[model samples]
Structure formats: structure tokens, C-alpha cells
Target: MPRLRANDIEQDKIARFERIKKAITALEKQQKQILKQGDLAPEGAWVARYQVSQNRKKYWYYKLQVPTPSLPCATSSKLSKYKHLGKAGTQEHIDAVMSVFRRSVWDEIQRIIHTLDDCLLDISSGSEQEEEEAQD
Candidate 1:
């Protein structure tokens, strides 16, 4: 077996780095596709609670705990804290759940893209350092 020279190893690393870059580009395209899927209201959290009616019939209700936008010199008030989404199994409830699920998927894709970017940076920097040492 022939011994691999430092230059040859560096070139191989560069090739792999380019491949990763292409993969990241593809992920970005998919991210855009996700945005175009449906309504992406990625704000607030869905809340579910059980309540008893006057006749002691227990039922579940869903609400969205939307955070009020902060303003300058705003007082601590409980205004527009939660918006009712009707009872469970309703269209509003189902839509809310699906919105949350889509947001989670979007977040995961962002995390993956960031990790790949970091890896590319690490590999490029290592290669630069190696080249500097080889010149000395």
C-alpha cells in the first residue's frame, strides 16, 4: 500500500467538505418547501385542560397561550394571555396541534443546517493550519 502524503489527505478532506456543502444547500431548499406547505403560525403554545360542567360532566378544552408583544413602558397586565380554541377534536384544536408539529420539524431542520455549517468551518480551518505548518 502506498503511503498517503499530507497534500493528498488535504485534497480528500476538501472533496468531502464540498459534498457536505451541497448537502446543506439541499436542506435549505427543503426548508423553503416546508414553509410553503401551509399556514406556519409558529408562535405561542397550545394548552389543554379538563373542566367539569354544571351537571358534573367532565370535558376538555384547548387554549393557545399567546405572549403579548412587548412594548416600551408596558405595565404587567394579563391581557390577551390565552385564546380559546374550542373543545378537543375540533378543527381549531387539530390545526393548532398540526401547526406545533410543523414548527418542531422546522426547528430540527435549522439545527441540522447549523451543525453542518459548523463542521465545514472546522474542517476548513484545520486544513488551513496544516498548510501553514507545511510551509514552515
Candidate 2:
């Protein structure tokens, strides 16, 4: 078998990279639109406010409360700290706390899915290109 030329390998690599980059850009744009839609959170779901201490500092956290049969009560699980107030019920308040939480959740899911989709697209494209070249 003959060895591959340096120029041929470089060109192949460049083509693969461009294909991967384009797929990633498209996936990122789609993910942004998904997050922007903001339909992840269910309508009329109650969000609770609570205070959690971290590193001896009090911080305000919010969580979505879903009524359950076993619990029969709204249980608050810590989600994220308010951007302004360090603790719950602090003087520094944030407007539309529920909206903030919903947005954060949407953004996080979008980011994770975007990364996975980009990686899969890159690998599949690269493999297909390699196979096509091998057959030639």
C-alpha cells in the first residue's frame, strides 16, 4: 500500500474541520431558538423561595414545587441563587423570579443538547468522508 501524501491529508483534515464547524454552528443556533421558546416549564407550576447557606454566606434559592400524592405538600428543593440577593427574602429582590428559573433551566438543557448534537454530527460526517475517500 502507498502512504498518503502530506498535502492530501491536510486537505482532508481541513475539509472535515469545516464540515464539523458548520454543523456545530447550525446546532448552536437551533439550541438558542429552543431555549428562547421557553416552553420547558409547565404552566401554573408553583415556584418556591428559600434560603441556603454556602461557605457561611446565606444565599437565596428558588425551586419549582410540584404537588405530589405521597408528600401531600409542596416541598422546596434548592435550585439556584438569585442574581441580586445573596439570601432568601433579602432587601435586594429580583423581578420575575420564576421567569429567571425557567430561563436558566431552558438554557442549560439547550447547551447540553447542542453540545451532544454537534459532537455526533462531527463524528458522523468525519467517518462518512473517511469511508468515501477509502473507497476511491
Candidate 3:
């Protein structure tokens, strides 16, 4: 097996750091566009539900992606935090769907950016440590 040299390792780290920085910049731009599109809409998912009772009723609701804090004495399930959108064919319903989609896309972009940021930090710190060792 061929052993890797210290110079080869340093080059690899620099390459990785550059790639991560590029990815983070792209993700930040996408996030900004998504935010601009969703500026007027509240972030949540549009949900449709059915009931066995009341003549098999169908309902539409908007459930927040992140649940809000509840009162100390409140005995509510996570599922109970939905806000009724009422009637799925309305313009409001369409807007709600768009809002949900925008929020989901934004969240995914943010997640990628965060993970890349961590990797970039790790690579930066590793390079710094190597430099210090080389100076000793």
C-alpha cells in the first residue's frame, strides 16, 4: 500500500474547505430567494383530515411545522395544534399549500447549509492545528 505524504493531506484539506465554501454560498443564495417568495405567508403544512362521524366529514387545516409552546395546564396532543383552513378549493387553500412547500424547501436548504458550515469549520480547525504542529 502507498502511504500518503503530509503535503498530500494538506492539499486534500484545502480542496475540501474550498468545496464546502462554494456549496454554502450557493445554499445561502437559494435560501434568500425562498425567503423572498414566502415573505407574506406563514410557515406551516396544509393538512386534510377525515372523520368517521358526522356523516364521514372531510376537513382542511394548516398545521405548523414547529409546534408552539403550550400552557402549563394544557392537556393537548401535538396533533391538536392545527388551524382550520376550511374548504380545500378556496384561494386561501392554494396559498396555504404554496406556503407549506416554500417552508419545506427553505428548511431543507438551511439544513444543508448548516451541515456544510460544520464541515468547513472542522476542516479549518484541522488545518490550523497542522500548521501549529509544523511550527513546533
Candidate 4:
């Protein structure tokens, strides 16, 4: 069997770490949006999609469309509709939902990080042993 170089293993581990970090950041942003606007409002926000092409490479991006009152003239109807908007439910309910979503994502990230840590430790230990054998 061929022995793996320490640098090679470390580079792979670092790349995995960076990818996990990016996922965590994205999740956190989603969680914040839910918390700030209340679950229903943000859920109803329209999604705008666009594609950009540069140097033969294409990338897609999405942004939330701001919601405006559909019945601008019906002041009473508008008030009644949005009356339950922020006051639809208790803060506890919103927090509970966000908590569940955040926890599940966080747990997955933690599991991946733990697995990568073990792999890094094993690689370091193996490299140390190899160095000792080379010296002997």
C-alpha cells in the first residue's frame, strides 16, 4: 500500500472544512430571515431568479421580492389582512419552528466536522509513525 503524505491529507481536510463552513453560513442566513420577518411573511416573499453569463460561465442567483399590498384602495381590507400578519401567532411558536430548523442543520454540520476531525487525527498519527519508522 502507498503511504499518504501529510500535506495531501491536510489539504483535503481543509477543503472539506471550508465547504461545511459555507453551508453553515447559508443556513444561518435563512434562519435569520425567518426570525426577522416572521415565518409566514418570508415564506410568502416572491423569489426572483436571474442568470448571469460571464466568459462562457453561467451562474444563477435568487432574491426575495418585496411584498406590496394588493388592494391599495381598500384601506379597511388591507388593514384586516395584515392585522394578523405579525400578530398571527405568539413569538414562542415562531422561535420553536426556527429552533427546530436550525438545530437539525447544526447537528448535521457537527457530525461532519466530528468525522473530519477524526480523519485528520488519524492522518497525523499515521504520518508521525511513518516518520519514526523512516528514522529507525
Task: Quantify all predictions' global Cα lDDT against the true fold.
Answer: 0.72, 0.55, 0.65, 0.50
Ranking by lDDT: 1, 3, 2, 4
Writing each residue's lDDT as its tens digit, candidate 4 over 1-136 gives 8877989777876676676567656666765665565343332334345577899998665433335543123345342212121222456435434544555555555566666556556555654345444563
TM-score of each: 0.71, 0.34, 0.62, 0.31
lDDT of 4 at 88: 20
Candidate 1 TM-score versus the reference:
0.71
Q: Model 1, residue 83: displacement in angstroms?
A: 2.5
Task: Please estimate how well model 4 matches the true structure, expressed as its whole-model Cα lDDT.
Answer: 0.50
lDDT of 2 at 61: 70
Worst 10 residues of 2 by lDDT: 78-87
Clashing pairs in 3: none
Per-residue accuracy of model 1 over 1-136 as CA lDDT, tens digit each = 9999999998999898999899999988988887787655445454556465767676668865546632222244645555567888889778777776677777788899999998898888773345444563
lDDT of 3 at 65: 29
Candidate 3 lDDT tens digits, 40-134: 23444444543333567654443332254321223445444455454656665666667778877888898898888888888878744554445
CA lDDT for candidate 1: 0.72
Model 3 alpha-carbon drift over 4 Å, by segment: 1-4, 40-46, 50-66, 69-82, 127-136
Which candidate number has the best lDDT?
Answer: 1
Which scores better on lDDT, 2 or 3? 3
